[model samples]
Target chain A: MGEFDLIQRFFLEGQGRLAAGDEVPVGIGDDCAVINPTPGMQWLVSSDMLVEGRHFLSTVAPERLGHKALAVNLSDLAACGATPRAFTLALSLPRADEAFLAGFARGLFALAQAHGIALVGGDTTAGPLNICITVMGEVPRGQALLRSGAQLGDDIYVSGTTLGDARLALELFRGTVRLAGDAFESVRRAMELPQPRVALGQALRGLASSAIDVSDGLCGDLGHILARSGVGARLEADALPRSATLAAQDLALQRLCTLSGGDDYELVFTAPAARRVEVAAAAALAATPVTRIGRIEAEPGLRLFDAQGQVLPLALSSFDHFKS
Target chain B: MGEFDLIQRFFLEGQGRLAAGDEVPVGIGDDCAVINPTPGMQWLVSSDMLVEGRHFLSTVAPERLGHKALAVNLSDLAACGATPRAFTLALSLPRADEAFLAGFARGLFALAQAHGIALVGGDTTAGPLNICITVMGEVPRGQALLRSGAQLGDDIYVSGTTLGDARLALELFRGTVRLAGDAFESVRRAMELPQPRVALGQALRGLASSAIDVSDGLCGDLGHILARSGVGARLEADALPRSATLAAQDLALQRLCTLSGGDDYELVFTAPAARRVEVAAAAALAATPVTRIGRIEAEPGLRLFDAQGQVLPLALSSFDHFKS
Candidate 1:
């Protein structure tokens, strides 16, 4: 397909999920997208890079690649308590294949429209598959959450269940998971198209002391919060929320993968004990469950505990961009 | 050096020229960088992708690559009449080499500081050499210029000299241009780091009817403005600005390179006929010369003219991302 035709067919079509506002003065087709600033709100912008064979396998579907690319960036905006407004994509492909660009743009527009975010200006270049998305959102000054704001004694919470996709990864690696069955397909879909909790994050802006998105496993990502906040965390192993998919896996292996395997894309945040009830209720209203997995402490190190309170030493492991 | 040290030694030690009001609240060293928006101004955002062997040669210097990556995006923001503030760099390298990253970061930081922009957040991944930069700037509401805003009878102008870099490219390709001498080195530098006319762009915000940065050669990029504005242009070959470097080359070959060769990164814009004197003065004050090379016409096609006022049929060739 021609570039103009491809853009019109995939991107110009209205997205039914999210509402567009006056601030997005120009969306999609332009040399540069224009956004009218809203009173009392400041724009928060962040960008993330996803490289083929590093972030995902070459065999991964184009649709999932598109979804995950925007999802990961949205997670960053969510961590900052910003409501999505618009984004620009810079995509590099070996070739401009009609089918591949169509599916990719379709997936990106779907997620962007779902969050009321408009696709702005971007560049397409010929190279190895490299997708970089810069997302912009609005947040009230001094109200946007930060990782350095976590206070001692604050409770740590995570949205959705952990270790679900890690278990699915194991099944696929072992050649036991088949995409033909509905259940297997669902599990794989969950692993591939993990949603970023945008609404829930916005709601937590005032309640949460600090926040982060769990792109690199919970342990490694939370450690970043701990280091930045100058606090420690004690996670309750028994309180950890493993999905039913993990419960079906080998117990020991599931526990290990849950702590080390990356690509969860969930938000891990810290809130005061006094606001726990309010935060929980908000998560419930959003239809996303919250798990109180840990608490912040004075010391600057992470520790895990079993049901009986036995100490469980954890390895500092996650997907390190350089090492991995 | 390790990843953390590489970040600290290169990225954290700022070197780029930053324009006023481009301070980054929380820069490198954190999990994510934070930018404090200038109140009362809407942010203008744009991104560009440059790939080795596609956009540049594998032999291009690391520092030049770094400069071009940010400069090109800054040019986009300039086209929109935004004062550049900050930029996020997503670089995919084949490996983690300290020397290369250090020089690259130095070049980028130099430009950032020069333009009063800060190095915000970005991702570093492993892949073929690719650089994508998302730059953010601020412009008052309803003030950002656009290519669609051009009106019939608008006087078209281009900043600085064009085709200089294209002639340099031809010389370099022929292996006749020795880089050992200072003059040849300057020519090579011009090819490597084509300045993005940021100041002229900012000044033209209220003065110009519409503007676009010339990256894909003058004829093609100007065609974008004409097509979008639903107007035509009559460009004078005699009025086209050519550098001494270009004038030294075969005249016909120089014209072809200037008109069709890409990667100029200069701003081409149109203004009301009454504003020409003021625009020329403003361009002089900014130390960037401007030439009225063309005029917007009521008809909807481009026409070129020779010094003798003879009509030269437009060649209509340009760089296309999808075209091989």
Candidate 2:
């Protein structure tokens, strides 16, 4: 298959599952996709790039790669409390393979269907495997949750655990760690297919003071919210949520992965302390658990505290694409 | 500089001219860009990918690469008769060089400022040179020019000239052809920095029944319009508008480049014979001259004719990433 046939057969031919009720007037086989926007709605757009060697391993499945490509972009929309509506995937492949395309289309459309996002338009090229996805969503004007909205004395909260087992999977792939059967599968799945917290983000609208998706480990991602909002945070180290599997690891490794692991794709937010019950109800409505781990302060720096209330030193860094 | 610093210094930090009256509420630093859409309008979205070796030669200037990358995508929007609004660039580079980034940013923003499109948000990473841009534009509801709107009796028209001189430049670079002095520079600029026929496309929205941008060669791209509109065309070979520089080339090379050369970035559209005056008026409004070179027919295949109306046999092929 050539690039045109590869895209047509895999993505646009019969996406019957994605086309129903879609607002797109012209799609796929056009110079541009025409999308009808809802009246009085603001649009949110974000693009993410995933390189083959840097973002994923060669041993990874094509289906997962497709899912992750779209998921990460959707996570950016989720961070802004936007509802995912449509996305474009610009894929560069070394060569065309029918089976790989089939699996990739399956995984990609599955996730798009789950989020009610239609595949709008994109380009196909031949090169080293690189996937760039741009996702578009809508929010009511002035209602978007931004990173600069964290207020002093607001309760800091996080959705899902502090760190998923994905970082552990990466460590295993790097030959820096080894795990048993079930543990290995769990971590690998987390790394390969991340679930963007779109619903939870929507639920936090008009309630959460500020929100950000934790793509880079908890500490660094939270630091973004702090820096943008010009506020400080005191995180309770002992209160950081962890999976039972991660709890089974050694103390140092557990802290290391939980504190600084990337690819978590979870939301960290802040809400007024008085709205604790409201926050809980919102999380319940989203069907995603939320944990209150700290509070935002007026000062412009972050501090970590153990159970004894002793301040801890900062030693780790976040994942920076160019710097790393 | 790192990726973040590179983007900050090169693109967003001082694009003050682009910020005035822009619809983007939260740009650059946020996870996603927030854009307010005008009421009663539809959005147009398109993405294009340019790889290092496949799309352009490494010897090409970084500034030209930046301009071409965004220009091609904007051309897609132009084909749909949408007003340029904003764009996101996912750029991958082998390393961060300040001078290269400075030149790229200058060329990119110069074109963007000319059209009032702002750079909203994007991601950058370390990898082989690959530039993926997703452009967003707006067209009033029900006014978008589409390829499916062409009628059987519509006259086929093209903006600017048929041959852009890009193919001749490519041939020169490949040692297949040689030009002297200014001719060489002119063709090289045509190849490296083809302008998007944005104003012409917008002017043709209500006048032209169907439209498309010529990127993959005049004949091949018009084939796209015909296929979608379920019609055929009878093209007059002698009527093709060619530049003086192209006419100076050998007849075979001139015909080949004008007929099947890629990267023209010109608009080919169709309108009713009765609307010929309106079409000319539209071109005047756009300040871009257009030539009538063909007519749509009820038949389902394209037929080319010379000055004496004798059918010409097809020989040349268009550029295809995978098959070629």
Candidate 3:
């Protein structure tokens, strides 16, 4: 198949054929997709690229890969307290595999429809498998959440009642850990699918002082917030959230998985201690549970404490594409 | 080096560190770059992906590769008569080659600065070499050009007086053609460095009925305008523009290069026959020479005629990444 046929057959047919509206005066099939920005809104743009073998295993299903590709980008928007608007996907595939394109489009559009976002435009080429998505969103002027907004004495919280299952699944796949049947399948799903906390991020816009999504592990990701906001953090390592399966593991394993387990798309945000009640209310409104695990400090270094308030000297590094 | 350090050392230091202004309030380092669109101006967005061994040869310099990667995307904006604003780049590299990156950034930022556009945000990963750029521009509402706006009696025109040097250079590279030293270098420059007709596109905003960038060959690209506008075209084959280097070649080779020469990032547009003088004025204002080579027809099929007014039976096809 030619590039045009592949796009027409998979992308420009169903879910990709979104109706043009006030926000998007022109969608795909044009020289460029056109957007009419709302009067009082600012556009939020985020781009994420996923490469085969580096970002995902060769064994991943095309449908799941498609979902994860867009999910990661949407996670960026959610971190900024932006409402999803539209996105463009630029993909490089080795060939025009009919089954792969069908499955990928089905999964991609499924998630797009769920968020009410449109696949406005993108490029399709022949090469090694690579997916690059640029998502555009809207946030009210002066209301966007930023990593530089955390204030001293602010309470640091994380959305989702459980996390770290994705890393656990990855470890299992690498044969470094072992799980059986349903347990393995459940954790594998966590590795394959992550829900962007878009609603929670928007709901915490006025309540949360700073925000970031957990992609490069909780500690490393939160370190960004501290560095940008010109503050430090005192993390209660024992209070870190974890799945029931992870919680049942050894204490060290639990800490390692919860603290340095990347791929969790949960939102890590900070709010004033006085607004703790309101933060809980907002979490409830978004139907995403939240737990406080730390606090911003005036000092300029991150410190971790155990249940007994004793400092734990555990070194953790986030996933860096170039380094390792 | 880690991803953050690589970006900081190269992208976020100078040219990439575009100051936040009224248009972009928050750029790189944020979860999502925020854009405050100008009121009454619609945003035009285009994305292009270049993969190694597919879009260009492995022998091409990293700097030239960087230039072409962005120029192709800007050509789309030019086709729409949109003024360049900002762009996001998502790059995947096999390794952290500092030299390659330095050269690429130099070429990329040079073009970006010339266009007065900012490198707002992007993602970097470790994988096969792939560059995906999503460019955002702006044009006055309802004044932006489109392929569907061409009228039946419109005269077709193309910017850049000399064309087909890119294809000639490619053929020479493949050892299918030969040229003298200076001539070869000149055509190679044409293939490596394409100047997008941004000024010409903007100047023709109200005059041109429809426009498209000739990336996939003039014949094929013009077919897009015809199909979209529901019109036909009578192309004067002998009038097709060609560089002196290409014109000196054999007639068959010259015709093939000029008619289906992909990589010519010039604008092919249509305008009312009565607006010939105005079109010439716009071309003069932009300092880009243009040639009238065809006319739109009410029929629904493209026809090519030689200087003798006889139909030419040329089997022309554009470059298709997949089919090729």
Per-residue C-alpha lDDT of model 2 across residues A108-148, encoded as one tens digit per residue: 88898899898888877888788899999999888888999
How does the DockQ of candidate 1 come out? Answer: 0.58
**lDDT: worst 10-residue window of model 2 chain B:** B315-324
A best-first ranking of the candidates according to their DockQ comes to 3, 2, 1
The TM-score obtained for chain B by all candidates, in the order given, is: 0.88, 0.94, 0.95
Kindly list the interface RMSD, in angstroms, of each predicted candidate in the order they appear: 1.8, 0.6, 0.7
Best by DockQ: 3
When 2 and 3 are scored with DockQ, the better candidate is 3
Give per-residue lDDT, candidate 3, residue A268.
94
lDDT of 1 by residue, B171-191 (tens): 565574444465566666666
Residue ranges of candidate 3 with Cα displaced over 4 Å: A1-4, A13-16, A316-324, B1-4, B12-16, B317-324
Candidate 1 DockQ category?
A: medium
| Per-residue lDDT over B1-324 for candidate 3, one digit per residue giving the tens place of the 0 to 100 score | 476456654765354456477778888887888888888889898889998766788888888988998999999999999999889998888778888888888788888888988888888888888999999999999888998999989999988856788888888887878899999999999998899899999999999999999988889889899988999999998898888888899987777777788889999999999999999999999999999999999998788888899887646434332122
Clashing pairs in 2: none
TM-scores for all candidates: the values are 0.91, 0.96, 0.97
Candidate 3 docking quality: incorrect, acceptable, medium or high: high
B1-324 per-residue lDDT for model 2 (tens digits): 357556654665356224524477777777888898888888999999899777889888989988988899999998999999888988888878778888888788889988989988888888877899999999989888887888989999988863749888888888878889898888888899988999998988888899999887898889888998999999886678887788898876776787788788999999999999999999999999899999999998788887899887666434332122
What level of docking quality does candidate 2 show? Answer: high
Candidate 3: lDDT of A105? 84
